[model samples]
Target: MRAVIATEPGGPEVLTVTEIADPEIGPGEVLLDVAAAGLNRADLLQRQGFYPPPPGASDVIGMECSGTVAAVGPDVTGWSVGDQACALLAGGGYAERVAVPAGQLMPVPDGVDLVTAAAIPEVAATVWSNVFMVAGLQPQETLLVHGGAGGIGSFAIQLAHQLGSRVVTTAGSADKLAACTALGADVAINYRDQDFVEVVAEQTDGGVDVILDNMGAKYLDRNIDALRTQGRLVIIGMQGGTKAELDINKLLRKRGAVIATNLRGRPVEEKSAICASVVQHVWPLVAEGLVQPIVGRSFPLAEAGAAHAYMESGDHSGKILLTV
Candidate 1:
C-alpha cells in the first residue's frame, strides 16, 4: 500500500510517499479502498509536531475518509463488502487504503459522490456533537460561529440555519462573510474590520445565545462579552495560543456555561453513539438535499504536502480533500 508518512515532523516537506505494509484489520473493522480523504487543520498541526495522534491510534495524519468496503472483519455484521461508506478516523487516512472500525463508519447518502462524502464525516461529527449535542443550540435562539467560511464553521452555519436559529458569523474578510451570508447566516461581520462583540450585541440587542469558538486564548474574553444571559459557549479547537484568562464575574452575571471539547480523543462507545445519531438524524437532511458537504479543492495522494501548504495559507474555503 502507498502511504504518506511524516518523517520527523516539521513542515509540509516532511510528508513522504512510500510503499508500506497494508494495515491489518481487527475484529469489527473493515478494509476500505479509499477514494478520498479530508484534510483538516489538525493534520497540519500533527505534521508540525504540535499534535500527536491519541493513544493507541495510527500515526498517519488523516482524520476522515470515504470509500468502498473491500472486506469486513470476521466479527462485523450488517455491513458487507462493497458498501459505499465514509468514516471518521483517529489516523491513517493519508493512504491508499485504511482499516476503519465498523462502529466509526456511516453509509454515504444517495446521489453524493465518494469524494464529497469524504468531506462530510469530520465536519458533521464535529459540529453535531459540539454545537448540537453539547451546547444544545435551540431553535429561534441566536448562534454565533467563528471562522464562518472554514470547514467546521460552514457546516455549523448551515445546521444552525436549518434548525431555525438566527445565525451570526465572524470572518477575516468581506468575501468570506458574503459566503457565510449565502449559507443562511443572518449576520456576518468582518472580524478584521470590526469587533464582533459590538456587532453581535447590536444585532441581538445584548449578545448571542450560543457561540462556537476555535480561537482559544485570543477570543476568550471577547467571546464571553458576546454571549447573552444563560448562553452556552462551546470550544472545539484552539487555533490561537493556549493559556487563557477569564472573568469570573461575567459568568456569574450571565449564568452561562463555558465548555471545552474534542471529538477525536473520545472513547469508542461515545464515537459510536455520535455515528448512530448522524445516521438516524443528519442523514435524512443529506438524503433530502437540504444539506451537502462542501469540498473546496482536491490534490492527489502524492501531493499531500501541497494540500498542507494550501490549508496553512488560509486562502481556501470549505474542506480540502486528498484523493487516494
Candidate 2:
C-alpha cells in the first residue's frame, strides 16, 4: 500500500507519497481499497505540525474517503467484500488502503459517482451536525457561514438554503461570493471590503439566528455582534488564530451561546450517529439533486503534496480530492 506522510512538520513541501504497510482491520472494522480521499484545512495544519491525529489514530493525514470494502473484521456486519461506501475517518484516508470502523461507513447516495462520494462525508457531517443538530437551526431562520467558498462553507450554504433557512455567507472575492449566492446564500459578503456584521444585521433585520464560523479569534468579537438574541455561534476551526477576548456582557444581553467543536476528535459512537443522521436526512436531498457535491479539483494520489499546496493557495472552491 502507499500513503502520504509529512517528512517533517513544515510546509506542503514536506508531504510525500511512499510505500507503507496496509492497515489491518480490527474487530468491528472494515478494510477499504480507497477510490479517493477528500482534502481538508486540517490536513494542512497536520502537515505544518500543528494538528496531530487523535490518540491511537493513524499518522497518515486525511479525514474522509470513498472506497470499496476489501474485507470485514470480526463483529462487523451489514458490509461485505466489494461493498462500495464512503467513510468518515479519524486518519489514514491518504492511503490506498485503510481500516474503517463499520459504524462510520456510509452508502454512496443515489446518482453520485464513487469518486465524487469522497467529497461528501466530512463536509456533510460537519455542516449537519453543527448547524442543525448542535445549533438547532430551523426553517425560516437566518444562518451565517464564514469562508463560504470553502468545502464546509459551501455545503452549509446549500444545505441550510434547501432546508428553508435564509443563508448569509462571507467570501474573499467577487467570484467566490457569486458561487456562494448560486449555492443559495441569500446574502454573500465580500469579507475583504464589507463589514459582514453589518450586512448580516441588515439582511436578517437584527442579526442571524445561527452562525457556522470557521475563523476563530479574529472573527470572534464580530461574530458575537452579528448574532440575534438567543442565537448560537458554532466555531469549528481556528484558522484566524486561537485566542481572543469575549464580551460576556454582550452575550448575556442577547442570551446568545458560543460553542467550539472538533469533528476529528469525536468518539466513534458520536460520529456514527452523525453519519446515520446524514444518511437519513441529507442523502435524500443529494439523491433528488436538491444538494450537490461541489468538487473543485483533483490530483492523483501520488500528487498529495500538490493537492496540499493548492489548498494552501486558497485558489479553489468546494472540496479538493486525491484520486487513488
Candidate 3:
C-alpha cells in the first residue's frame, strides 16, 4: 500500500508517498481499501511537527476517509466485505488501506459519491458533536461560527441553519463570506476588516446564543463579549495561538460556560458514540439535501504534498480531499 509519510516535520515538502505494508485489523475493526481521504488543518499541523497522533495511532496524517470494506475482523458486526463506508479515524487515512473500528464506520449517504463521502465524516462528526450535542444549539437560538468557509465551518453553517438556528459566521474575504451565505449563513462577517462582535450584537438582540470557535485564545475575550446571557462557547481549534486571560466577571455576569474540546484524542467509546450521533441526526439531513457535502478540491493520493500546500494557502472554501 502507498502511504504519505513525513520524512521530517517542517513543511509540505517533507511528505513523501511510498509503498508501505497494508494494515492488519484486530477484533472489532475493519480493513478498508481507501477510495479517498479528507485533508484537515490537523494534517498540516502534524506535518509541521505541531501535532502528533494519539498513543498507538497510525502516524499517517489523515483523520477521515471513504472506502470499501475489504475484510472484517472478529467481533465486528453489521459490516461485511465489499460494503461502502466512510469512517472517522484517529489516524492512517493518508494511506491506501486503513483499519477502522466498526463503530467508526458510516454507510455512504444516499446522494454522496464514493470520493465525496470522504469529505463527510470528520466535518459531520465535529460539527454535530460540538455545535449540536455539546453546545445544545436550539431551533430558535442564534449561533456564530468562526472560519465559516472551512470544512467544519461550512458544515456547521448548513446544519445549524437547517436546524432552524440563525447562523452568523466569519471569513477572511468578501467572496468567502458570500460563499458562506450561499451555504445558509444568515450573516457573514469579514474578519479581516470587520468586528464580528459588533456584527453579532446588531444582528441579534444581545448576542448569539452559541459560538463554535476555532481561534482559541485570540478570540476568547471577544467570544465572551459576543455571547448572550447563558450562552455556550465551544472551542475546538487553536489556530489563533494558545493562552489568554479570561474575565471571570464577564462570564459570571452572563452565567455562561466555555468548553474546549478536541476530537482526535478521544477514547474509542466516545468517538463511536459521536459517530453514531452523526449518522442518526446528521445523515438524514444530508440524505434529504437539506445539508450537503462541501468538497473544495481533490488531489490524487500521490500528490498529497500539493494538497497540503493548497490547504496552507487558505484559498479553499470547503473540504480538500486526496483521492486514492
lDDT of 3 at 39: 94
lDDT of each: 0.90, 0.94, 0.95
Question: TM-score: which is higher, 1 or 2?
Answer: 2
TM-score versus the correct structure, for each prediction:
0.98, 0.99, 0.99
Expressed as tens digits, the lDDT of each residue in 1-324 for candidate 1 is: 999989996989999999889889989899998999999888988999988998988888899999999999989987988899999999999998999989999999877888889999999999888888889888999999999999988988998998899999988887888889998899999988899999987888779988999988889899999999999998877888788989999987999899998888898889989988988878888887777787789999999999999999999889999998
Across residues 209-261, which tens digit of lDDT does each residue of candidate 2 receive? 99999989999999999999999999999989999999999999999999999
Residue range with the least summed lDDT across 10 consecutive positions in model 3: 197-206
Worst lDDT run of 10 residues, candidate 1, spans 286-295
Model 1 error, position 224 (Å): 0.5
Residue 243's lDDT in candidate 3: 98
Candidate 2 local lDDT, residue 254:
91
TM-score quality measure for candidate 2: 0.99
